[model samples]
Target: MHTSSARDAARIRVCHIVHSGKVGGVEVAAALLQAEQHPSINYQVAVLAQLPDGEPQAIKAPDCVGHGLNNPLSVLPVLKWLHRNAPDIVVASLWRSVLVGMVAKLINPKRKFVIFLHNTQYKNVLDRAAHRLGFRLADGIFCDAPATRQAMTAELPLETGQIHVVPLVARGGRSRHTPEAEQGPVGAVAGGEIRCVFWGRLAKQKRLDRAVHLLAELNNRATVPVRLDLLGPDEGELDEMLRLARSLGVEQQLHWHGAADWGRIRDVASGASFFIQLSDFEGLGMAAVEAMQLGLVPVVTPVGQIAEFTSDGVNALHFDSAAPVAERMLSVVGEPPMWERMSAAAVAEWSGQEDLSTAFETVCRQFLANQQANAANHVIRGAVS
Candidate 1:
């Protein structure tokens, strides 16, 4: 049996309340942070919905309150849990969790609350209104990237002091490309098949149709056969994307691996060449970073923090009407020197990031320290008065 020492018992308790316990970048990031062994932080993940079963879990969630987001009683269970457990701090991960955390703080104003911003775009007007109101009640905010923080402050009444930019580090993956291979002469590998991979939700914002078009264009230009792999759960665009690929006569070249964990992704994508994500917007484009960690050059639209980190024709190929995405990709495909250089650059960029668990702990402790300082000042002023 395991037991806590006095020092361990004295550590700050942190509960990250998330909307769902399913496998995705946000949920996986939260789960990994919770699993990290910290000397001064005891982390717990509480999902609004029941923990999912029999599906490939990215990381096992710790707690489930048995409530759904749309249910009117959703906040009550979370509030009740907060009261029963009395964690020292609550970090709400998504917009829905923000509402629950805001309500809990209103009822128990002594507890500290923080918001972890995940995206740069709002789902709707309702989401925008809720964030504007809910964020005002948060003690602090941690954004996935600077772009997320900038977008929030630009539209909402948020101060720069209240927000912190802490990029999430990629969970490790297998490296497929080597520096020697990258430095080779310009051309396709002898008898090699060109493979491209995309790992994210099949949603409209991802614009997967554009990926299919790119595939057709690549095959049209290349002497070798080209294939595209799609990974992640279908978020209502599967049928349309399949039909479009069929119409373009590239259905055979499209591979679908639904809702995969990181291990599975590495196993399947290890030999892949390019990681493609032309999302309309992203907080940090985490999957792209993950791909980079594996030495896969990115062919992404320069939006959100993707623009901040990637350099066009240097580490990545950026397309935004300056030229078609296919044209940019073809430029890399025909030039082994350029492709190898980009691959090496992508790997080096991600390897330079801080360790994942340490980054999370640092951000959480900063928020806790600030809250304690503020509380101490308030008490001192009261005693003086």
Candidate 2:
């Protein structure tokens, strides 16, 4: 991918390589960082795959080099493209992108490599091997969460100083927990329904079917009328989820929100009493974190970094299955004081978090300085020789 600004002598160019040109959490994070990054740094993206029609645009910022390879077989072309327009630094995101980035780095050893480790688990064996290779080959690593960094350190034989943990923060941050504009009038009651919100891709990893069953159990076993506003794009599993909800007689109670934009999600979150997700596992659980920062009580599974921040009855409730999840749900709804206390704790958890954009900038600057020092040392050695 060519960054025309790279030739401007005053600019420092960096590019992020990812598997797809779709609007997912990582893509959103990259877009946010590109928009908020230092003006002198020229940022671009090399999407490894061409996303299908109707998919959200991967790169949101203007003047971006959206390099999407049409097929996996075109690996040579991708490498040639990287070699032709080598950025000062290339950040590889996800396991697949890591593989591509490692190959590109081998072909063009002059460019600095940074692996963006976002997932704690790489399910594919070959991908996992490639991920480790990329980590070992990179000049630095940026972990999405502390837990992710710990996993990499424990399993991969790598230097600890090369890894940096940067926890992601939601946009539109505030000083304290406050009511959102989309929320009902403070303490207002309408139809006595408890509004629950869930956001993430509609796939098996999310375990949203668990959410449907939990809602049914909550409605059947408790006094509160529970309704879930399931937000996110369907990844070929929404049909099965709807069927399961219908079989359990919860079809009417479920609200299907298809791929809501960030602004719309913020509004929905403002009015929600609790945000719930029981994903099989999460790398960082950014969606859940966003909801918690909005002052919504979290009913999340103890997965990934979620367990590090949320306590069972303090900041968030834990839910592994239908029975226990319903029990916790009812407990939160029945006791207003209990949830209020949890809400305060939840806000406190994210109260003093450093802006994620600033964290990214800090790492980029630190690594850039290292790259320069290494170059200078090589120059000195050359002169001595």
Candidate 3:
């Protein structure tokens, strides 16, 4: 119901297309951006896959569209939808969505397309080709981290001018910490319960097995008892990680809480003293940021844009995947003062300048300005003709 000025009446219509409507950091980010878009802009969302009946949905974008395409020819419906909607700009949030957007742009050459890079690495040949084609056809590119921006330019041979490094907006505010007394009768630490938390999908790329191994090694060396709380959705590699933990004889020290709701995940994180992310590569490390916000010192691999928000011995404790991860974790666990210092720094980092609202507004204004310029050029050309 918001309106714009006469000069701003040419509202930029933006559509965010993603592969799935399921809940995750990327989906949450898209939903946040959609909800926070300026009144002058027209926003819509389209998911390549449809959500099931009675599933809890988080998207607030005005006009959510879905295409239930299960086959190779399923892309046709998406292309047709794009043509019919004819948005002034389309932003694809994932690889498959990028491919759909590229084809849609190819069919309707007048519309502009943009790709938002959310992952740290790209390997699929089809996805790479589609991304390249999309880049060639896109008017601009938005990356969630500076490292990602650099990698994309190096990998695709694109100019720096075309790529923009817009860091991921922190979706949640400061988290409330739970006191030790309020932890709800969890076992005493005397039995060797050193609670460690890991949040992300249980996929091979995440290296969940490596995390479990690190926890097992910690338990082996600890004079006191220790336990690891592995929280996330079990996909392809969950069973492997569980079996590895059992084989190492540390299964008792590890607990699988399955995938948790965002609120519950935050609550679980508040009570834990440490968080670990063992991803082979990442774009922005959203969960790490969230964990830091909740006062959990993170022990993470220096991949993707992790170094942007964290530094070794500062906001976070960093470890290289090649080195002894278990040894690195032990060093922090053994030093109480160091752990406390890192936890304080982590909380401070989250409170610093990573405001999502400011970043979202900047991008929208830039998009609107560019659209208006293009419209002015068209008018000038028509007058001349």
Best by TM-score: 1
- Cα lDDT of model 1 by residue, 1-385, tens digit: 5466777667778888887766778887876776665667777777777645777665565564636767758887777777777888888887778888888889888788888888888877877777777777888888999998888766655443456777786565322222344322121222368888898888888989888888888877777888998889888999999999899899999999888886677766776778889888889888888877777788898888999889888888886642377777766767777788888888777765665566777877777777777778779999999
Candidate 2, pairs of clashing residues: 183-271
Superposed Cα deviation of residue 164, candidate 2 (Å): 1.4
Report the Cα lDDT for residue 342, model 2.
Answer: 79
Q: List the candidates' TM-scores in order.
A: 0.88, 0.83, 0.82
lDDT of 1 at 120: 88
Q: 1 or 3: which has the higher lDDT?
A: 1
| Candidates' C-alpha lDDT | 0.76, 0.72, 0.69
lDDT of 1 at 377: 78
Which residue pairs collide in model 1, if any? 182-340, 186-336
**Cα deviation of 96, candidate 1, in Å:** 1.9
lDDT score, candidate 3, position 280: 86
> Is 1 or 2 the stronger prediction by lDDT?
1
lDDT of model 2 at position 41: 63
What's model 3's lDDT at 261? 57
